[model samples]
Target: MHIKQATPALKAVAALLLTAALSSCGQSQNAGMPAAGPASVGVITLQPQDTVITRELPARISAFTVAEIRPQVGGIIQKRLFTEGSNVKAGQVLYQINPDTYQAAYQTAQASLAKAEATLTSADLKAKRYSQLVEIKAISSQDNDDARAALLQARADVATAKAAVETARINLAYTRITAPVSGRIGKSSVTAGALVTANQTTALATVQQLSTAYVDMTQSSTDLLRLRRDFAKGALQNQSGKAKVKLILEDGSEYAQPGELEFSDITVDSGTGMVTLRATFANPTGELLPGMFVRARLEQGVRHNALLVPQPAVSRNQKGEAVVMVVDRDNKVHARTIKTSQTIGDKWLVDGGLQGGERIVVEGLMKVQDGATVKPEPLKSNASAAK
Candidate 1:
């Protein structure tokens, strides 16, 4: 019986020793795992210089000056002097009206003016002789007064004739239809034989000043208010008050010259809830035409001390907030929530949650979990990451 009890005690001691040995082995394996350190994230250094924030806006081309040419005098179109769809300068003759009748009227007025001047000279001589005779009692005072009145009447007649001559001259000059503005002229509405009236509703042609063009765009009032607030808070600045604009044509080709903002509508449109904005660009080549659809990018403001990060480094949490994996000094990975504002270029602008010089994960994020120990490795360039 004593031998049987010793055998059972020895078995119990062996079992305890085996259990402790297994536990020690497990602890040793855990200790051999490498501790996590700074992750190999694609990082861009924070910049303090001015960075422009641009907004792509849809717009249309417009003319700075447009006019509908009309006739100023009533007459038949004698000749069409210019080719249709040609550039015209101000005061350039465009059409010629028959001036035979107007010329005759002018000559008649000039003859009447000459006759009246002769009558005035004779009346003046008669009035002077009559005045001398009245002083010598050789003529009556009433007769002398009549002679003076005749001279004044002749002078009045000459003045009337002169006015008539001026009127005729103006009518004669009106026979030539000239361009009131310098621009590109459209096709003529009336041909050489067609009769046109003074101030007619139908235009003779259309002229549009395309040397300098206008680009019309719209912006929401809410956006403008937000931008203004940010500007007042020193968060944004229009380093270029009239920031340069870039045009994207319908065919996707960029315009050669840059434009500048010219005007912004004061009142907002109640129907669309947007305010109209205009930009001016020099179109020396006439490539940009009126009513052409276009896309314009306007630089709103520049941000100083901006932090931009790669989009892959940012992830969404359960709350739908953006989060990034940061490696702490203790060589452990920790998930951090960040606040983001807008996007500049291809990266996101981080408003909060990241300090400079902190390493975030750009790769191997799926292989590890929170607080997991890892061996940090350099990120290899791949097609999935930003170029």
Candidate 2:
């Protein structure tokens, strides 16, 4: 019985060995065990770019010119000369006070002026007559002297009357209120028949010159200090030395126009440690308004001849430093640590750890390790394959 069992076991073992040998042979040829070469990978050719670094900051829209209109003379508004919310030019009549009152005063001034002129003429004639009388002794010396004194008094009274006329004319002219600036007028604070006071606490109306608007932004002092430090170290490049700024509205849409950095506050706020910046934009269409919130992009600097790589190619290592896989001329892949400033479009502005003309492993980063050999196809071809 033992010999019979052993014979069957041996047959089973031999069959198992034959099956293993056949499987090995098939795998070696068809299963890609020996004949297959290294797999192809996607890569990007490192190139230099004139990259600009910028900071996006929150901003608020402000009117370039703001005016609070108040009456200069206390009177009832007789007529609203300007339509509410209409554009007005400088010196344009905005409101007409009861011109009847002013006209009457003006006419009174004219009468006073005529009376003063008549008095002046009488004084001149009397003075000439007195001089002739004194020279010819046709009248007593005291009488001539008294006539001269009377003429002098009349001249002084005429001068005083003329001044009163001028004062009355000026007061009459102040009855009509006009716009001091060219701008879009706001709602009428005082309607027709409403009583308005001169330089009163209540404004007659508000006018905002929106032809050119201002976007006021603020940046942290820390960011400014960092930029200054980087500039000092020559790690960053600033085109035009100072950066140009642009705006994005609150709706996340970029403004149709661009703006320049007009001013940066020299003093930083003690509480917020922020420095204010202002950008001016032409708003001829009046699309921008005062107190509208928006975003401003301040172009802090530019990086000349920068080695750019896709953001996907960059990974953070254990120490939190950015690293990318680059293939050398021999197609040997190596992990290079890089210091990046910021992103421009789809790539990062590399500040260090990369030279121009290296093949950066953009797509096949996961497939290759440090010092691994790769067959790098053109990055464009790999991108197309992905799509």
Candidate 3:
């Protein structure tokens, strides 16, 4: 029985030795397979700077000046003097009216003026002779007085005739319809031989000045108020009280010319709760047309010490907040939640959570996790462009 108990003890010791040998062999195999190093990740260092924030609003283009052509006198239109859609200068005659009646009236007034002048000359001679006779006691004082009165009446008649002549001359000149402003004229509403009256309700043609254009942008009153409030709080400085504007065409292309803010309407549209803001732009090529739809982007404010991160480094979390993987000074990876205000190109403008002088991973994101050590490398190309 003692020999059997010793044999069982020997078997137990052999089993324990086998287990130790297996563990040692497994550890040796793991060591020979090569231990994995830290994950390789591409990182970018962020710096703070003053960044301009722009707001885009829908806008419509309008001409700088608009002129409506109308006749100043009553007459039959003799001819249309200008080609439709042609540029016209101020004071340029655009239409010809029948001036025969006005010419006749002018001539009649001139004849009346000449006859009155001749009568005045005769009366003057008679008055002078009567004055001499009266002085020599060769004629009664009442006769001289009557002669002087007749001369005065003749002079008054001449003055009245001169005024009538001037009136007729002005009326004759008005027969020619002229342009009130220099601009491109639209199609004529009245054709040749069309009758027009003085101060007619209908316009003969429309002229629009297109060398410079106006961009009228409509923005919500609430947004405008918020911008004003931000401005007042020193968040934005309206440099020189004029902000620069950028134009975007309907096809999603930016306009070559830049513009400046002109004014903001004080009254809001009751129906839309929106305020109109005007911007002036150079339209030398006439590319901007009146009533054309467009978009205007203008600097709303400047954010000081703002951090911008490359979009590659940013990801969305389960809570829908923007998250980025930040590599700390220890080279350890950590997920960061940051607030973003807007996207400037391919970078996100960080509003909060993350700050300047922090490093964030931009590449090799799949190889990293929270609490994992990483091999950090600078992000290529994007750093120079972002700056």
Best by TM-score: 2
lDDT tens digits, residues 1-387, model 1?
Answer: 889879988999999999999999999999999976544433333333446777778899998899887887788899999999999999999999888888999999999999999999999999999999999999899999999999999999999999999999998998998888999998999898898888899999988999999999888999889889989999888774677888999999999999998878999999999988899999999999999999998888887776666787778998999887777666567888999876655667788988766666666778666885555543554222322
What are the models' TM-scores? 0.74, 0.77, 0.76
Ranking by lDDT: 3, 1, 2
> Sorted by TM-score, highest first, which candidate order results?
2, 3, 1
Query: Per-residue lDDT for 13-99 in model 3, tens only?
Result: 999999999999999999899779998888878888777878889999999999998888899999999989889999999999999
| Model 2 Cα shift for residue 211 (angstroms) | 3.0
lDDT of 3: 0.90
- Give candidate 2's total backbone clashes: 0
**Candidate 2 lDDT over residue span 1-387, tens digit each:** 889879988999999999999998987788665565555778877667666678889899999998888887788888889888899999998888776776787788778778877877887797789789888888888887877887888778778777877877777788878888999999988888998877899888888999999889999999889999978887677686445777888787888888888888999999999999998999978889999999898888765676767888899999999999888888888888999877766767787898876778777777888887889888655432222
Cα TM-score of candidate 3? 0.76
Worst 10 residues of 2 by lDDT: 378-387
Residue 271, model 3: lDDT of: 100
Judge candidate 2 at residue 149 and give its lDDT. 86
